[model samples]
Target: MAIALNTKLAEGVQKAAAEAGLAVVNGQESAGFNGIPTEKYTLALVSAPEGHTFTLELSAGFDITAANIAPAVRAYLLESAKRLTNPRPDVFVTLGGLPVSFTNWQWPFHLSVSGADTYVVHGGATLEDGKTAADQYLKAKVSASMTVTFAEVVAAPEQPFAEGFIYNAVRKILDQGQMELTKSGGNRQVVPVTTRYYSAKQGKFIFNDTTAQQRADYLLSKIYWLSGVLGGGAPVWIADPRDAQYLNTTVEELKKTAESLAGEGILKLDPKFEYASSTEPLMAHHAEYEHHLQDALDFTRPTFNEEMRAGHTNM
Candidate 1:
Protein backbone atom coordinates (compact mmCIF):
# COMPACT_ATOMS: atom_id res chain seq x y z
CA MET A 1 0.00 0.00 0.00
CA ALA A 2 1.13 3.59 -0.70
CA ILE A 3 1.82 6.05 2.07
CA ALA A 4 -0.79 8.70 2.78
CA LEU A 5 -0.28 12.23 1.47
CA ASN A 6 -0.47 15.32 3.63
CA THR A 7 -4.04 16.62 3.32
CA LYS A 8 -3.24 20.32 3.21
CA LEU A 9 -0.40 19.92 0.71
CA ALA A 10 -2.41 17.71 -1.61
CA GLU A 11 -5.43 20.04 -1.55
CA GLY A 12 -3.33 23.13 -2.22
CA VAL A 13 -1.36 21.50 -5.01
CA GLN A 14 -4.49 20.21 -6.71
CA LYS A 15 -6.20 23.60 -6.38
CA ALA A 16 -3.20 25.42 -7.75
CA ALA A 17 -2.81 22.96 -10.59
CA ALA A 18 -6.48 23.29 -11.53
CA GLU A 19 -6.28 27.07 -11.49
CA ALA A 20 -3.35 26.83 -13.88
CA GLY A 21 -5.46 24.84 -16.42
CA LEU A 22 -3.93 21.55 -15.35
CA ALA A 23 -5.49 18.43 -13.92
CA VAL A 24 -4.12 15.94 -11.46
CA VAL A 25 -4.12 12.84 -13.60
CA ASN A 26 -2.68 10.65 -10.88
CA GLY A 27 -1.37 10.82 -7.34
CA GLN A 28 0.54 8.25 -5.32
CA GLU A 29 3.11 7.82 -2.64
CA SER A 30 6.74 7.68 -3.74
CA ALA A 31 10.21 7.44 -2.27
CA GLY A 32 13.10 9.83 -2.42
CA PHE A 33 16.84 9.26 -2.84
CA ASN A 34 17.24 7.80 0.64
CA GLY A 35 13.84 6.13 0.80
CA ILE A 36 12.14 9.11 2.40
CA PRO A 37 8.39 9.12 1.90
CA THR A 38 6.95 11.53 -0.65
CA GLU A 39 3.73 12.55 -2.34
CA LYS A 40 3.98 12.39 -6.12
CA TYR A 41 1.49 13.92 -8.56
CA THR A 42 1.29 13.58 -12.29
CA LEU A 43 0.09 16.89 -13.70
CA ALA A 44 -1.17 17.31 -17.28
CA LEU A 45 -2.67 20.19 -19.20
CA VAL A 46 -6.43 19.96 -19.61
CA SER A 47 -6.41 21.29 -23.17
CA ALA A 48 -3.09 19.98 -24.27
CA PRO A 49 -2.33 20.07 -27.98
CA GLU A 50 -2.96 17.00 -30.09
CA GLY A 51 0.01 14.61 -30.39
CA HIS A 52 1.32 16.18 -27.16
CA THR A 53 0.12 15.14 -23.76
CA PHE A 54 3.09 16.11 -21.65
CA THR A 55 3.04 15.05 -18.03
CA LEU A 56 5.12 16.62 -15.28
CA GLU A 57 6.09 14.83 -12.08
CA LEU A 58 5.82 16.85 -8.88
CA SER A 59 7.03 15.24 -5.68
CA ALA A 60 7.12 16.77 -2.23
CA GLY A 61 9.14 15.39 0.65
CA PHE A 62 8.92 18.40 2.92
CA ASP A 63 6.10 19.81 4.99
CA ILE A 64 4.19 22.01 2.56
CA THR A 65 1.28 22.69 4.87
CA ALA A 66 2.49 26.14 5.93
CA ALA A 67 0.67 29.20 4.54
CA ASN A 68 3.91 30.71 3.32
CA ILE A 69 4.71 27.61 1.30
CA ALA A 70 1.39 27.71 -0.52
CA PRO A 71 2.22 30.75 -2.64
CA ALA A 72 5.55 29.35 -3.79
CA VAL A 73 4.00 26.01 -4.65
CA ARG A 74 1.16 27.73 -6.48
CA ALA A 75 3.59 29.80 -8.52
CA TYR A 76 5.63 26.71 -9.35
CA LEU A 77 2.65 24.67 -10.49
CA LEU A 78 1.35 27.56 -12.58
CA GLU A 79 4.72 27.96 -14.26
CA SER A 80 4.98 24.21 -14.67
CA ALA A 81 1.72 24.15 -16.60
CA LYS A 82 3.23 26.62 -19.01
CA ARG A 83 6.49 24.71 -19.20
CA LEU A 84 4.80 21.35 -19.87
CA THR A 85 3.37 22.76 -23.08
CA ASN A 86 6.96 22.82 -24.28
CA PRO A 87 7.83 20.15 -26.86
CA ARG A 88 10.24 18.66 -24.35
CA PRO A 89 9.80 20.00 -20.83
CA ASP A 90 12.53 17.70 -19.53
CA VAL A 91 15.14 19.03 -21.95
CA PHE A 92 17.23 22.11 -21.11
CA VAL A 93 19.63 24.07 -23.27
CA THR A 94 23.15 24.85 -22.11
CA LEU A 95 25.00 28.12 -22.75
CA GLY A 96 27.37 26.00 -24.81
CA GLY A 97 24.39 25.86 -27.17
CA LEU A 98 23.68 22.21 -26.47
CA PRO A 99 20.38 20.64 -25.48
CA VAL A 100 20.39 18.11 -22.64
CA SER A 101 17.49 16.03 -21.35
CA PHE A 102 17.20 15.68 -17.55
CA THR A 103 15.38 12.72 -16.11
CA ASN A 104 15.28 10.01 -13.40
CA TRP A 105 15.40 12.85 -10.91
CA GLN A 106 15.17 12.01 -7.22
CA TRP A 107 12.68 14.69 -6.38
CA PRO A 108 12.57 17.12 -3.45
CA PHE A 109 15.52 18.22 -1.34
CA HIS A 110 17.06 16.17 1.43
CA LEU A 111 18.86 17.70 4.38
CA SER A 112 22.45 16.66 4.92
CA VAL A 113 23.16 14.50 7.97
CA SER A 114 26.93 14.73 7.50
CA GLY A 115 27.18 17.74 9.84
CA ALA A 116 26.99 19.96 6.77
CA ASP A 117 24.66 22.94 6.66
CA THR A 118 23.16 22.11 3.28
CA TYR A 119 20.43 20.31 1.35
CA VAL A 120 20.83 18.28 -1.82
CA VAL A 121 18.83 16.79 -4.71
CA HIS A 122 20.08 14.23 -7.19
CA GLY A 123 19.28 13.74 -10.91
CA GLY A 124 20.70 12.79 -14.30
CA ALA A 125 21.09 14.83 -17.50
CA THR A 126 21.67 13.20 -20.88
CA LEU A 127 23.01 14.92 -23.97
CA GLU A 128 20.29 14.72 -26.66
CA ASP A 129 22.56 14.20 -29.63
CA GLY A 130 20.20 11.61 -31.18
CA LYS A 131 23.26 9.42 -31.57
CA THR A 132 24.73 9.03 -28.11
CA ALA A 133 23.70 5.95 -26.15
CA ALA A 134 20.92 6.58 -23.64
CA ASP A 135 22.89 5.14 -20.74
CA GLN A 136 25.37 8.01 -20.87
CA TYR A 137 24.35 10.88 -18.61
CA LEU A 138 25.64 13.45 -16.18
CA LYS A 139 24.83 12.53 -12.58
CA ALA A 140 24.11 15.82 -10.83
CA LYS A 141 23.75 16.67 -7.16
CA VAL A 142 22.22 20.11 -6.67
CA SER A 143 22.91 21.60 -3.24
CA ALA A 144 21.74 24.64 -1.32
CA SER A 145 23.53 26.19 1.63
CA MET A 146 21.70 26.97 4.89
CA THR A 147 22.23 30.72 4.56
CA VAL A 148 20.80 30.98 1.06
CA THR A 149 18.09 28.48 1.91
CA PHE A 150 16.76 30.76 4.63
CA ALA A 151 17.63 34.12 3.04
CA GLU A 152 16.51 33.69 -0.56
CA VAL A 153 14.90 30.29 -0.83
CA VAL A 154 11.90 29.41 1.26
CA ALA A 155 12.60 28.11 4.76
CA ALA A 156 11.72 24.57 3.70
CA PRO A 157 13.77 22.80 1.07
CA GLU A 158 10.85 22.23 -1.27
CA GLN A 159 10.63 21.71 -5.03
CA PRO A 160 9.13 25.11 -5.82
CA PHE A 161 11.98 27.08 -4.30
CA ALA A 162 14.88 24.83 -5.30
CA GLU A 163 13.96 23.37 -8.70
CA GLY A 164 14.49 26.50 -10.80
CA PHE A 165 17.96 27.37 -9.55
CA ILE A 166 18.92 23.74 -9.55
CA TYR A 167 18.17 23.53 -13.23
CA ASN A 168 20.02 26.78 -13.87
CA ALA A 169 23.01 25.64 -11.85
CA VAL A 170 23.25 22.52 -14.00
CA ARG A 171 23.24 24.68 -17.11
CA LYS A 172 25.77 27.04 -15.51
CA ILE A 173 28.10 24.15 -14.75
CA LEU A 174 27.81 22.85 -18.29
CA ASP A 175 28.45 26.33 -19.69
CA GLN A 176 31.57 26.77 -17.59
CA GLY A 177 32.84 23.32 -18.63
CA GLN A 178 32.71 22.14 -15.04
CA MET A 179 30.77 18.91 -15.65
CA GLU A 180 30.42 16.41 -18.43
CA LEU A 181 27.76 13.86 -19.30
CA THR A 182 29.47 10.48 -19.24
CA LYS A 183 28.67 6.79 -19.27
CA SER A 184 26.72 5.11 -16.45
CA GLY A 185 29.83 4.12 -14.50
CA GLY A 186 30.87 7.74 -13.80
CA ASN A 187 30.43 9.23 -10.34
CA ARG A 188 27.88 11.90 -9.49
CA GLN A 189 29.16 15.49 -9.81
CA VAL A 190 28.18 18.22 -7.38
CA VAL A 191 26.47 21.32 -8.76
CA PRO A 192 26.74 23.91 -5.99
CA VAL A 193 23.33 25.60 -5.97
CA THR A 194 23.04 29.17 -4.72
CA THR A 195 20.93 32.30 -4.96
CA ARG A 196 23.52 33.83 -7.27
CA TYR A 197 21.39 32.24 -9.98
CA TYR A 198 18.34 33.92 -8.45
CA SER A 199 17.75 37.65 -8.50
CA ALA A 200 15.71 38.65 -5.43
CA LYS A 201 15.75 42.18 -6.80
CA GLN A 202 14.18 41.09 -10.05
CA GLY A 203 12.11 38.33 -8.50
CA LYS A 204 13.41 35.72 -10.97
CA PHE A 205 16.24 33.32 -11.73
CA ILE A 206 19.22 34.46 -13.80
CA PHE A 207 21.40 32.04 -15.70
CA ASN A 208 22.93 33.63 -18.78
CA ASP A 209 23.30 37.11 -20.24
CA THR A 210 22.22 36.69 -23.86
CA THR A 211 21.72 39.15 -26.69
CA ALA A 212 18.68 39.29 -28.98
CA GLN A 213 20.57 37.54 -31.74
CA GLN A 214 21.81 34.97 -29.28
CA ARG A 215 18.30 34.33 -28.07
CA ALA A 216 17.15 33.96 -31.66
CA ASP A 217 19.91 31.50 -32.35
CA TYR A 218 18.98 29.61 -29.17
CA LEU A 219 15.35 29.27 -30.23
CA LEU A 220 16.37 28.07 -33.67
CA SER A 221 18.80 25.61 -32.18
CA LYS A 222 16.12 24.44 -29.75
CA ILE A 223 13.80 23.72 -32.63
CA TYR A 224 16.55 21.96 -34.49
CA TRP A 225 17.56 19.75 -31.58
CA LEU A 226 14.17 19.11 -30.02
CA SER A 227 11.62 19.29 -32.80
CA GLY A 228 13.60 18.55 -35.90
CA VAL A 229 15.83 15.93 -34.42
CA LEU A 230 14.06 14.41 -31.45
CA GLY A 231 10.38 15.37 -31.64
CA GLY A 232 9.49 14.04 -35.10
CA GLY A 233 8.86 17.58 -36.38
CA ALA A 234 6.32 18.34 -33.69
CA PRO A 235 5.66 21.87 -32.53
CA VAL A 236 7.38 23.35 -29.50
CA TRP A 237 6.19 26.01 -27.06
CA ILE A 238 7.94 29.24 -27.89
CA ALA A 239 7.01 31.12 -24.74
CA ASP A 240 8.45 28.71 -22.20
CA PRO A 241 9.33 30.33 -18.83
CA ARG A 242 12.25 27.95 -18.43
CA ASP A 243 13.69 29.26 -21.67
CA ALA A 244 12.85 32.82 -20.61
CA GLN A 245 14.74 32.35 -17.35
CA TYR A 246 17.62 30.70 -19.16
CA LEU A 247 17.87 33.51 -21.70
CA ASN A 248 17.10 36.19 -19.12
CA THR A 249 14.25 37.40 -21.34
CA THR A 250 10.47 37.63 -21.15
CA VAL A 251 7.92 35.23 -22.59
CA GLU A 252 6.57 37.95 -24.84
CA GLU A 253 10.02 38.39 -26.36
CA LEU A 254 10.15 34.69 -27.10
CA LYS A 255 6.77 34.89 -28.79
CA LYS A 256 7.98 37.77 -30.87
CA THR A 257 11.06 35.83 -31.84
CA ALA A 258 8.93 32.92 -32.92
CA GLU A 259 6.72 35.23 -34.90
CA SER A 260 9.82 36.63 -36.56
CA LEU A 261 10.96 33.14 -37.43
CA ALA A 262 7.53 32.34 -38.80
CA GLY A 263 7.60 35.48 -40.90
CA GLU A 264 10.99 34.46 -42.28
CA GLY A 265 9.55 31.06 -43.26
CA ILE A 266 11.82 29.28 -40.79
CA LEU A 267 8.88 28.21 -38.61
CA LYS A 268 5.19 27.40 -39.00
CA LEU A 269 3.10 28.68 -36.12
CA ASP A 270 0.08 26.83 -34.84
CA PRO A 271 -3.33 28.48 -34.91
CA LYS A 272 -2.84 29.69 -31.33
CA PHE A 273 0.45 31.35 -32.32
CA GLU A 274 2.19 30.12 -29.16
CA TYR A 275 3.60 26.86 -30.45
CA ALA A 276 5.66 26.51 -33.63
CA SER A 277 6.89 23.67 -35.80
CA SER A 278 10.05 23.81 -37.77
CA THR A 279 9.69 24.36 -41.53
CA GLU A 280 11.84 23.15 -44.35
CA PRO A 281 13.77 26.39 -44.19
CA LEU A 282 14.70 25.65 -40.60
CA MET A 283 15.35 21.99 -41.25
CA ALA A 284 17.66 22.91 -44.09
CA HIS A 285 20.08 24.29 -41.53
CA HIS A 286 20.78 20.83 -40.12
CA ALA A 287 24.41 20.97 -41.07
CA GLU A 288 24.85 24.31 -39.34
CA TYR A 289 23.16 23.05 -36.21
CA GLU A 290 25.31 19.92 -36.24
CA HIS A 291 28.39 22.10 -36.46
CA HIS A 292 27.15 24.22 -33.51
CA LEU A 293 26.49 21.11 -31.43
CA GLN A 294 29.94 19.74 -32.12
CA ASP A 295 31.46 23.10 -31.19
CA ALA A 296 29.49 23.26 -27.96
CA LEU A 297 30.45 19.72 -26.96
CA ASP A 298 34.09 20.49 -27.66
CA PHE A 299 33.92 23.75 -25.70
CA THR A 300 32.38 22.04 -22.68
CA ARG A 301 35.15 19.39 -22.65
CA PRO A 302 38.21 20.01 -20.48
CA THR A 303 41.71 19.83 -21.87
CA PHE A 304 44.79 18.52 -20.03
CA ASN A 305 48.39 17.82 -21.02
CA GLU A 306 48.57 14.04 -20.57
CA GLU A 307 52.13 13.86 -21.95
CA MET A 308 53.41 16.50 -19.53
CA ARG A 309 51.68 14.79 -16.58
CA ALA A 310 53.36 11.52 -17.59
CA GLY A 311 56.83 13.23 -17.54
CA HIS A 312 57.14 12.80 -21.31
CA THR A 313 57.41 16.55 -21.87
CA ASN A 314 59.00 19.56 -20.11
CA MET A 315 56.85 22.27 -18.55
Candidate 2:
Protein backbone atom coordinates (compact mmCIF):
# COMPACT_ATOMS: atom_id res chain seq x y z
CA MET A 1 0.00 0.00 0.00
CA ALA A 2 1.36 3.45 -0.93
CA ILE A 3 0.76 6.13 1.69
CA ALA A 4 1.47 9.44 0.00
CA LEU A 5 3.63 11.85 2.02
CA ASN A 6 2.88 15.03 0.11
CA THR A 7 1.73 17.93 2.27
CA LYS A 8 2.65 20.73 4.69
CA LEU A 9 5.92 19.18 5.92
CA ALA A 10 8.58 21.36 7.50
CA GLU A 11 11.82 20.93 9.36
CA GLY A 12 11.60 21.35 13.12
CA VAL A 13 14.05 24.22 12.98
CA GLN A 14 12.26 25.86 10.04
CA LYS A 15 8.82 25.57 11.67
CA ALA A 16 9.93 27.14 14.95
CA ALA A 17 11.79 29.92 13.16
CA ALA A 18 8.79 30.70 10.96
CA GLU A 19 6.38 30.70 13.92
CA ALA A 20 8.69 33.16 15.65
CA GLY A 21 8.66 35.33 12.45
CA LEU A 22 12.25 34.31 11.88
CA ALA A 23 13.37 33.17 8.41
CA VAL A 24 14.72 29.70 7.75
CA VAL A 25 18.51 29.51 7.94
CA ASN A 26 19.18 28.15 4.43
CA GLY A 27 16.57 26.02 2.68
CA GLN A 28 17.78 23.69 -0.08
CA GLU A 29 15.84 21.37 -2.44
CA SER A 30 16.85 18.02 -3.93
CA ALA A 31 15.28 14.93 -5.61
CA GLY A 32 16.41 11.32 -5.62
CA PHE A 33 15.30 8.67 -8.15
CA ASN A 34 15.31 4.91 -7.81
CA GLY A 35 15.74 2.43 -10.73
CA ILE A 36 17.63 2.28 -14.06
CA PRO A 37 17.45 4.34 -17.22
CA THR A 38 17.60 1.43 -19.66
CA GLU A 39 16.60 3.44 -22.77
CA LYS A 40 19.82 5.47 -22.72
CA TYR A 41 22.09 5.08 -25.80
CA THR A 42 24.69 3.10 -23.82
CA LEU A 43 22.00 0.49 -22.92
CA ALA A 44 20.58 0.25 -26.46
CA LEU A 45 21.83 -3.30 -27.21
CA VAL A 46 21.96 -4.79 -23.72
CA SER A 47 19.77 -4.00 -20.65
CA ALA A 48 22.36 -1.67 -19.18
CA PRO A 49 20.66 0.85 -16.87
CA GLU A 50 21.66 4.14 -15.20
CA GLY A 51 20.02 6.91 -13.12
CA HIS A 52 20.59 10.73 -13.07
CA THR A 53 21.38 13.19 -10.24
CA PHE A 54 20.48 16.79 -9.30
CA THR A 55 21.03 19.00 -6.25
CA LEU A 56 20.31 22.51 -4.97
CA GLU A 57 22.67 24.08 -2.43
CA LEU A 58 21.88 27.50 -0.98
CA SER A 59 24.04 30.09 0.79
CA ALA A 60 23.57 31.33 4.34
CA GLY A 61 20.53 33.47 5.29
CA PHE A 62 18.33 32.14 2.53
CA ASP A 63 14.79 30.78 2.03
CA ILE A 64 13.47 28.78 -0.93
CA THR A 65 9.86 28.34 -2.08
CA ALA A 66 8.43 24.86 -2.64
CA ALA A 67 7.24 25.67 -6.17
CA ASN A 68 10.74 26.42 -7.55
CA ILE A 69 11.87 22.93 -6.47
CA ALA A 70 12.49 20.37 -9.21
CA PRO A 71 9.79 17.87 -10.20
CA ALA A 72 12.16 14.85 -10.23
CA VAL A 73 14.26 13.97 -7.13
CA ARG A 74 16.85 11.37 -6.26
CA ALA A 75 15.49 8.65 -3.96
CA TYR A 76 18.18 6.03 -4.57
CA LEU A 77 21.73 7.25 -4.91
CA LEU A 78 24.71 6.32 -7.09
CA GLU A 79 28.34 6.07 -5.79
CA SER A 80 28.99 9.77 -6.43
CA ALA A 81 26.26 10.88 -3.93
CA LYS A 82 26.72 10.93 -0.16
CA ARG A 83 24.46 8.82 2.09
CA LEU A 84 24.06 9.42 5.78
CA THR A 85 21.63 8.74 8.65
CA ASN A 86 20.84 11.79 10.76
CA PRO A 87 19.14 12.42 14.10
CA ARG A 88 15.44 11.96 14.78
CA PRO A 89 13.89 15.16 16.11
CA ASP A 90 11.04 15.43 18.58
CA VAL A 91 7.97 16.19 16.45
CA PHE A 92 4.17 16.39 16.90
CA VAL A 93 2.37 15.35 13.70
CA THR A 94 -0.99 16.20 12.02
CA LEU A 95 -1.32 14.26 8.79
CA GLY A 96 -3.86 14.21 5.90
CA GLY A 97 -5.27 17.72 6.06
CA LEU A 98 -5.94 20.66 3.75
CA PRO A 99 -3.57 23.61 3.27
CA VAL A 100 -3.91 26.71 5.48
CA SER A 101 -1.33 29.19 4.18
CA PHE A 102 0.50 30.32 1.04
CA THR A 103 4.07 30.75 2.30
CA ASN A 104 4.56 28.05 4.96
CA TRP A 105 1.45 26.20 3.80
CA GLN A 106 2.90 23.79 1.19
CA TRP A 107 5.94 21.70 1.95
CA PRO A 108 9.08 21.10 -0.10
CA PHE A 109 8.82 17.48 1.01
CA HIS A 110 11.11 14.77 -0.41
CA LEU A 111 9.03 11.71 -1.34
CA SER A 112 9.28 8.21 -2.86
CA VAL A 113 6.75 6.20 -4.87
CA SER A 114 6.11 2.76 -6.39
CA GLY A 115 3.77 1.18 -9.01
CA ALA A 116 2.23 4.33 -10.53
CA ASP A 117 4.52 6.60 -12.57
CA THR A 118 3.61 9.71 -10.52
CA TYR A 119 0.86 10.95 -8.20
CA VAL A 120 0.30 13.70 -5.62
CA VAL A 121 1.28 13.00 -1.98
CA HIS A 122 0.20 15.42 0.75
CA GLY A 123 0.89 15.54 4.50
CA GLY A 124 1.59 17.75 7.55
CA ALA A 125 2.11 17.72 11.35
CA THR A 126 0.49 19.13 14.53
CA LEU A 127 2.82 20.84 16.99
CA GLU A 128 -0.09 20.75 19.40
CA ASP A 129 -3.65 20.11 18.30
CA GLY A 130 -5.20 20.90 14.88
CA LYS A 131 -4.55 24.65 15.11
CA THR A 132 -1.93 27.39 14.73
CA ALA A 133 -0.21 25.86 11.65
CA ALA A 134 -0.23 23.04 9.12
CA ASP A 135 2.92 22.06 7.13
CA GLN A 136 1.97 20.29 3.89
CA TYR A 137 3.61 19.13 0.60
CA LEU A 138 3.16 16.99 -2.53
CA LYS A 139 5.56 15.40 -5.08
CA ALA A 140 5.50 12.95 -8.02
CA LYS A 141 8.33 10.53 -7.60
CA VAL A 142 10.56 10.42 -10.68
CA SER A 143 10.45 6.64 -10.34
CA ALA A 144 8.31 4.29 -8.29
CA SER A 145 9.99 3.76 -4.91
CA MET A 146 11.24 0.44 -3.64
CA THR A 147 12.60 2.06 -0.45
CA VAL A 148 13.16 5.69 0.55
CA THR A 149 15.30 7.79 2.87
CA PHE A 150 14.76 11.48 3.58
CA ALA A 151 18.28 13.02 3.93
CA GLU A 152 16.78 15.99 5.71
CA VAL A 153 13.42 15.47 7.48
CA VAL A 154 10.31 13.51 6.54
CA ALA A 155 7.04 14.49 8.29
CA ALA A 156 4.69 11.88 9.71
CA PRO A 157 1.03 12.65 9.37
CA GLU A 158 -1.73 12.64 12.02
CA GLN A 159 -2.67 9.18 13.28
CA PRO A 160 -6.40 8.61 13.22
CA PHE A 161 -8.24 8.59 16.57
CA ALA A 162 -11.97 8.40 15.89
CA GLU A 163 -11.77 7.35 12.28
CA GLY A 164 -11.41 3.60 12.66
CA PHE A 165 -13.23 1.98 9.73
CA ILE A 166 -14.51 -1.38 10.97
CA TYR A 167 -15.62 -0.08 14.35
CA ASN A 168 -17.15 3.02 12.81
CA ALA A 169 -19.17 0.92 10.35
CA VAL A 170 -20.37 -1.38 13.09
CA ARG A 171 -21.41 1.61 15.19
CA LYS A 172 -23.31 3.13 12.29
CA ILE A 173 -25.30 -0.07 11.75
CA LEU A 174 -26.09 -0.31 15.46
CA ASP A 175 -27.12 3.35 15.73
CA GLN A 176 -29.36 3.09 12.70
CA GLY A 177 -30.91 -0.11 14.00
CA GLN A 178 -31.57 1.59 17.33
CA MET A 179 -33.36 4.36 15.49
CA GLU A 180 -35.48 1.71 13.75
CA LEU A 181 -36.29 -0.12 16.97
CA THR A 182 -37.19 3.07 18.89
CA LYS A 183 -37.37 1.03 22.04
CA SER A 184 -34.90 0.49 24.85
CA GLY A 185 -33.49 -3.06 25.07
CA GLY A 186 -31.07 -4.92 27.30
CA ASN A 187 -27.59 -6.11 26.39
CA ARG A 188 -27.17 -9.23 24.26
CA GLN A 189 -24.51 -11.85 24.80
CA VAL A 190 -21.94 -12.15 22.00
CA VAL A 191 -22.01 -15.94 21.94
CA PRO A 192 -19.31 -17.64 19.90
CA VAL A 193 -20.78 -20.91 18.66
CA THR A 194 -19.64 -23.81 16.51
CA THR A 195 -21.74 -26.51 14.91
CA ARG A 196 -21.72 -30.17 15.93
CA TYR A 197 -22.41 -32.53 13.06
CA TYR A 198 -23.33 -36.25 13.09
CA SER A 199 -20.59 -38.40 11.65
CA ALA A 200 -21.20 -42.12 12.14
CA LYS A 201 -17.65 -43.08 11.17
CA GLN A 202 -15.96 -40.39 13.30
CA GLY A 203 -18.64 -39.84 15.99
CA LYS A 204 -20.33 -36.48 16.47
CA PHE A 205 -17.83 -33.66 16.00
CA ILE A 206 -17.78 -29.93 16.11
CA PHE A 207 -17.48 -28.36 12.65
CA ASN A 208 -17.72 -25.13 10.71
CA ASP A 209 -20.52 -24.67 8.23
CA THR A 210 -22.92 -22.10 6.74
CA THR A 211 -25.57 -22.87 9.38
CA ALA A 212 -25.29 -19.48 11.08
CA GLN A 213 -25.48 -17.72 7.74
CA GLN A 214 -28.47 -19.78 6.69
CA ARG A 215 -30.19 -18.92 9.98
CA ALA A 216 -29.45 -15.25 9.50
CA ASP A 217 -30.82 -15.37 5.97
CA TYR A 218 -33.97 -17.15 7.11
CA LEU A 219 -34.58 -14.48 9.75
CA LEU A 220 -34.03 -11.75 7.19
CA SER A 221 -36.18 -13.20 4.44
CA LYS A 222 -39.03 -14.25 6.77
CA ILE A 223 -38.83 -11.19 9.06
CA TYR A 224 -36.71 -8.28 7.78
CA TRP A 225 -34.27 -7.94 4.92
CA LEU A 226 -30.70 -6.98 5.79
CA SER A 227 -29.84 -3.42 4.81
CA GLY A 228 -26.12 -3.95 4.33
CA VAL A 229 -23.10 -6.18 4.85
CA LEU A 230 -20.11 -5.40 7.09
CA GLY A 231 -17.33 -7.30 5.45
CA GLY A 232 -18.52 -10.92 5.58
CA GLY A 233 -20.56 -10.56 8.74
CA ALA A 234 -24.30 -10.02 8.74
CA PRO A 235 -25.51 -6.52 9.62
CA VAL A 236 -26.85 -6.40 13.13
CA TRP A 237 -28.44 -3.63 15.24
CA ILE A 238 -28.47 -3.07 18.98
CA ALA A 239 -30.58 -1.00 21.37
CA ASP A 240 -27.62 -0.02 23.58
CA PRO A 241 -24.74 2.14 22.37
CA ARG A 242 -22.91 2.01 25.71
CA ASP A 243 -20.94 -1.05 24.58
CA ALA A 244 -19.79 -0.88 20.99
CA GLN A 245 -16.12 -1.22 20.13
CA TYR A 246 -15.61 -3.51 17.19
CA LEU A 247 -12.63 -1.36 16.31
CA ASN A 248 -10.33 1.12 18.00
CA THR A 249 -10.41 0.36 21.75
CA THR A 250 -12.97 -1.72 23.60
CA VAL A 251 -13.34 -2.46 27.32
CA GLU A 252 -15.17 -5.00 29.56
CA GLU A 253 -15.53 -2.94 32.76
CA LEU A 254 -18.46 -0.73 31.72
CA LYS A 255 -21.23 -2.70 33.45
CA LYS A 256 -19.18 -2.86 36.62
CA THR A 257 -18.54 0.86 36.52
CA ALA A 258 -22.18 1.60 35.79
CA GLU A 259 -23.30 -0.55 38.71
CA SER A 260 -20.70 1.04 40.99
CA LEU A 261 -21.75 4.51 39.89
CA ALA A 262 -25.47 3.74 40.28
CA GLY A 263 -26.68 5.12 43.59
CA GLU A 264 -29.75 6.04 45.68
CA GLY A 265 -31.14 9.16 44.00
CA ILE A 266 -29.42 9.65 40.63
CA LEU A 267 -31.42 9.25 37.40
CA LYS A 268 -28.93 9.21 34.49
CA LEU A 269 -25.17 9.77 34.62
CA ASP A 270 -22.51 10.84 32.09
CA PRO A 271 -19.45 8.81 32.87
CA LYS A 272 -16.95 7.70 30.21
CA PHE A 273 -18.92 5.02 28.37
CA GLU A 274 -16.40 2.20 28.80
CA TYR A 275 -18.44 -0.69 27.46
CA ALA A 276 -16.96 -3.44 25.26
CA SER A 277 -18.62 -1.72 22.29
CA SER A 278 -17.91 2.03 22.19
CA THR A 279 -18.36 1.72 18.44
CA GLU A 280 -21.94 0.56 19.03
CA PRO A 281 -24.60 3.04 17.98
CA LEU A 282 -26.59 5.16 20.43
CA MET A 283 -29.66 3.15 21.34
CA ALA A 284 -32.90 3.95 23.13
CA HIS A 285 -31.65 1.81 26.02
CA HIS A 286 -29.07 4.54 26.68
CA ALA A 287 -31.79 7.11 27.34
CA GLU A 288 -32.64 5.24 30.53
CA TYR A 289 -28.96 5.05 31.41
CA GLU A 290 -28.98 8.83 31.59
CA HIS A 291 -31.90 8.75 33.99
CA HIS A 292 -30.24 6.08 36.14
CA LEU A 293 -26.96 8.01 36.18
CA GLN A 294 -28.61 11.31 37.13
CA ASP A 295 -30.43 9.55 39.95
CA ALA A 296 -27.16 8.00 41.11
CA LEU A 297 -25.51 11.39 41.30
CA ASP A 298 -28.47 13.23 42.86
CA PHE A 299 -29.02 10.50 45.40
CA THR A 300 -27.38 12.87 47.88
CA ARG A 301 -27.60 16.06 45.80
CA PRO A 302 -29.80 17.81 48.44
CA THR A 303 -26.80 17.59 50.82
CA PHE A 304 -24.13 18.59 48.20
CA ASN A 305 -21.70 15.70 47.82
CA GLU A 306 -18.19 16.35 46.41
CA GLU A 307 -18.42 13.42 43.98
CA MET A 308 -21.54 14.93 42.42
CA ARG A 309 -19.58 17.98 41.28
CA ALA A 310 -18.67 16.38 37.96
CA GLY A 311 -15.15 15.00 38.10
CA HIS A 312 -12.72 15.47 35.20
CA THR A 313 -11.46 12.19 33.74
CA ASN A 314 -9.48 11.13 30.68
CA MET A 315 -10.17 7.54 29.66
- The C-alpha lDDT values of all candidates are 0.70, 0.21
lDDT for model 1: 0.70
Which runs of model 1 end up more than 4 angstroms from their true locations? Answer: 1-6, 47-67, 135-151, 305-315
Q: Give the per-residue lDDT of model 2 (tens digit) for 1-315.
A: 011222233233234323333332233332222221111000010111122211222212222233322111111111012111101111111111111110111222123343433221222111111122323222111111111221111112101111111122222222222211101211221111112122335432212122333322222221111111111122222112211122111123333333332231111223442211111222223344334323432331234334455664443
Instruction: Report the Cα lDDT for residue 228, model 2.
Output: 16
TM-score per candidate, chains pooled: 0.83, 0.14
Model 1 residue pairs with clashes: none
TM-score for candidate 1, please give it: 0.83
Top candidate when judged by lDDT against the true structure: 1
Deviation in Å, model 1, residue 264 alpha carbon: 1.3
For every candidate, C-alpha RMSD to the true structure in Å: 3.7, 25.0
lDDT of 1 at 134: 54
lDDT of 2 at 305: 38
